[model samples]
Target chain A: MKIKPECATCIIRQIVDISIEVTDDEIEQFRLVKGCMPVINEEYHNNAVPAWMGTVIHRHFKKISNCEDPYKRLKETANDTAQNYIEDVENKIKNSDNELDRLKKCVLATIAGNSIDFGPFSISEDIVPMIEHTLNSELKIDCSKELLEDLKSAKKVLYICDNAGEIVFDILLIKMIKKYVNDINDIVVAVKGKPILNDATMEDAENLKINEFAKVITTGSDIIGIILEECSEEFLKEFEQADLIIAKGMGNFESLTEYNLNHKKLYYILKAKCDPVAEFIGVDLKDSVLLSNKQLQKNLANIDKN
Target chain B: MKIKPECATCIIRQIVDISIEVTDDEIEQFRLVKGCMPVINEEYHNNAVPAWMGTVIHRHFKKISNCEDPYKRLKETANDTAQNYIEDVENKIKNSDNELDRLKKCVLATIAGNSIDFGPFSISEDIVPMIEHTLNSELKIDCSKELLEDLKSAKKVLYICDNAGEIVFDILLIKMIKKYVNDINDIVVAVKGKPILNDATMEDAENLKINEFAKVITTGSDIIGIILEECSEEFLKEFEQADLIIAKGMGNFESLTEYNLNHKKLYYILKAKCDPVAEFIGVDLKDSVLLSNKQLQKNLANIDKN
Candidate 1:
């Protein structure tokens, strides 16, 4: 998605959130914020997506403030909070009568995990209410039925995880997919090779014991989302091999939606947290979205024809 | 009144609103928006208020876009719309039994005019509903009684106007003050020397026929709000001599609040439109405030003591 005027504001807001977390020095915080404006003006053009812009701006923030992984403590806290709800969520999925119902519940659970993000604003101390709220609410863009059909036929399913605490929830969905849709051997979970925001890394996947359920690998880059050009050749081979890809969070949706990789099917499961993403997905801000590549292509085709 | 992190976001949003109005070229709009970030970063620091920062950033926007007075058409529309309702508003005040009651109603009418601003967002097609809503609503910070008391004793009153459409409402209040509290000869109306945002200029004041009601003058600068240092020698003289100064809009509130001008009384009458301004005034966003310098000093003194 091209950077809209609102995106510039959002990028600065995110920087402020991180700046506050990194330091209590008012002067230093002020300087850090002041420094970001030039980078935003220069780097945030040429139809840059938020994730790509976030990557560049955040790196600059870290360099100036000398605070690597500013979201470190928050990530741990989010993981712990999300860990508490894992059992309850698993039971909710288990309680559903049929396999299709279970699969749909898992998709909702995964999308609920996307809400545990700390990059945009301060991390919520309690995600229990958000988890419950999302579970009860209907997905604004639900392509779960289509996703289930694709999952059944796909040989390999690549699950891209978003935030740290949310990775615990992703485990539940992965387990459900293995039990109902695909073999465990065919499922692989991809995490960031390094930290960018609170996006899960191999370290988080290891901490969550993701390897116990399915194979885990890194995208081989610390970039916020899957910037295909920046990814390692090994990760690309895996990406190209996968029959179905489940992208989690707004970052992935932004980076992936820019190009048409017609060789593979992509299903995005995330909460539309910002205006541009919400407008793009035809949903309200904060609405959970389960969108399919097929549906997106059809929408694009319609727009082109008009 | 000091700049907060939220103010940066708001400034960018305002730029976006103006950029969209200036051009249809996405690339040009993109370039214009990108250019604004550095100005915002550089100007909006070290406890700078929005008005001060806005003055600097908006000047750059105009320089780049080559569109001076971008809000010209919207300002005309706001004036026409507000003019249509002047009769109904005057009637509402006339229905009041006493002078004090009529004065209070006029104060409300003037605040209702402040809502016609088009700088931050698109101009509302109709302001009748907003005026009606504001009329029926209670002021979140009403110092009208105190203002009335000050006006009764004061020999000279300097009334600063905010926007074009709202100036008509200011006329009603100015007329009321002339009839009940002070002579029309003692009253002076101050507007911008040149166009800045949708803020009222000498042209607008003349268009509204403000001379028929009282003496009218310009502040001798095109800056938003009453920057005391930037005022012309004549305006400074009037500003100094006035027994009581009635500053209109959030711009005045911001610029005036920075100094402790103890010699003369100042009453700010405006709607709190943004988060930082609302927080500064201790009112909710969109709430109307009629704050007196006397009350503000008292509040400040109490805070100091605490």
Candidate 2:
């Protein structure tokens, strides 16, 4: 989707926040933030993608501050916090009444785990208590049933991940799908090539042991989401071959449609973190959605007809 | 005060808000907002005064939108809202036992009346119940007693007005002051030369019959706050001559300090609407402050020493 004027303020806020996170010296903070103003001047407009603009400015922030990952500490904490719940999640899945129930629980956890994101919190937001919270709160757009049906006949599944801590749950989710849906033979997981706002890097995927379940590849750039031009030939090949694509986080939800992979069933699983995104998605702000790209098209068509 | 990095986002939000307020046509709204991005590009910096930058952007918005007053309806509604409460405020002041109490009530009413501002709300927020609410809410940094003392010795008072609706209560504030302070001979009310935001204009003052209470003058340009460079020599003379300058609203509170009028006993009376301004004033957000410019100098000096 094209950027709203609201995105201009929101991106600047993110830039200023990371500037503060990277430095304590008020003069340095001012310099760091002031220097990045030109990025917004260049990138904010009607035609720019919000995530694409967010990527450019955050990359600029990384350059000016001489910081590889401003969200390093937060990402580590998010990872540690999520990793702590692995055994409990495993136990919960095993205790479920049936494989269908287990699959639903796993899917729900992956979506809910997104809330333990750096975009919202400065530190680790414990996801242990959140398991119960997710169970009680229904997805605003529930497509888990349809997702399972799509998975039943699929030979390959591509899982694109979001944040550091959230990726661990996604790995566990992949395991459940592999076990339950026997037809899903091949699975490819995608993480960012480098750090961009606490997004999972190759190092995070390695640390989390994601390759034990599925072949993990990098998106080849530190962009905010899946901006196709910024991706590698290797990632593009997998994106083309995949039968079903499961995209996580608002960042991926924002950028995935740009690639036109709707012919291949693409399910967007996220907690809409912003107004414009949520409003576009036909949900309330912070609503958890497991929506297909086909559903996105249908929703847009309905809105147009209205 | 120099602009904070956060101010960039805030100014953009203001620009976008007025764009929406000015027109319903989506393409025109986008055009109006996009056309003004260069203003922020030119004006945003560490050393630039926020109100000055604010002035530049809003003026740019006015020019691009081709609408002289985007807030005309809102301003009229605000004035009407405050005008409805004049009799009740008058009766409350008269029924008070002593002149000192009546003076305090009038001062509180002027400060409280500013909440009927455009910056916070889209529509008119009634100020009737606000009178009692104002009486109950204590000032965060009150110099009202000192203000009354200063008014007693001064033969001249320049009440730099803020918004359209709030000026109605301020006119009544002047009437009460003229009655109680026998030494007060000349009372001059300063308003914007043109409509800026929802700030009071010459026409508003004329319509509200402000001339019956005090000589109404304009600051010569439609700037957000007092930009000394933007003011005419005629208004500058009055600014120089006034013994006690009672500046209302956050706009005047922000700009009056820029004029180096600390020696002139300038009293700032308004609710600190945003965090950065409140932080500078050593108060919490939304706290009503009746502070002195000398106090601002003291606060900065102490910070430098610390």
Fnat values, one per model, are 0.59, 0.52
Instruction: Give one digit per residue, the lDDT tens place, for model 1 in B1-306.
Output: 677765676688778878877888878888898888777877878678778899888888999999888778878888898988888888898899886677778888998898888754444345567778888778888787888788788788899988889998899888867754356667889999888888999989888788887889999998889788899998998898888899999888888888877666889898887767886677788788888888877776776787
C-alpha local distance difference test of each model: 0.82, 0.78
RMSD of 1: 3.5
TM-score of chain A of each: 0.94, 0.92
Model number with the top DockQ: 1
User: Could you tell me how far off, in angstroms, the CA of residue B275 lies in candidate 1 after the best superposition?
Assistant: 4.1
Clashing pairs in 1: none
Question: What DockQ does each listed candidate score?
Answer: 0.48, 0.40
Give me the displacement of residue A284 in model 1, in angstroms. 5.2
B18 in model 1: Cα distance from truth in Å? 1.0
Superposing every Cα of model 2 onto the true structure, what RMSD results? Answer: 3.9
Off by over 4 Å in 1: A73-98, A116-140, A181-185, A202-208, A232-234, A279-287, B76-105, B116-142, B181-183, B278-287
Q: What's model 1's TM-score?
A: 0.88
Residue B184 lDDT in model 1? 63
Q: How many residue pairs clash in each candidate?
A: 0, 0
Query: Candidate 2: DockQ?
Result: 0.40
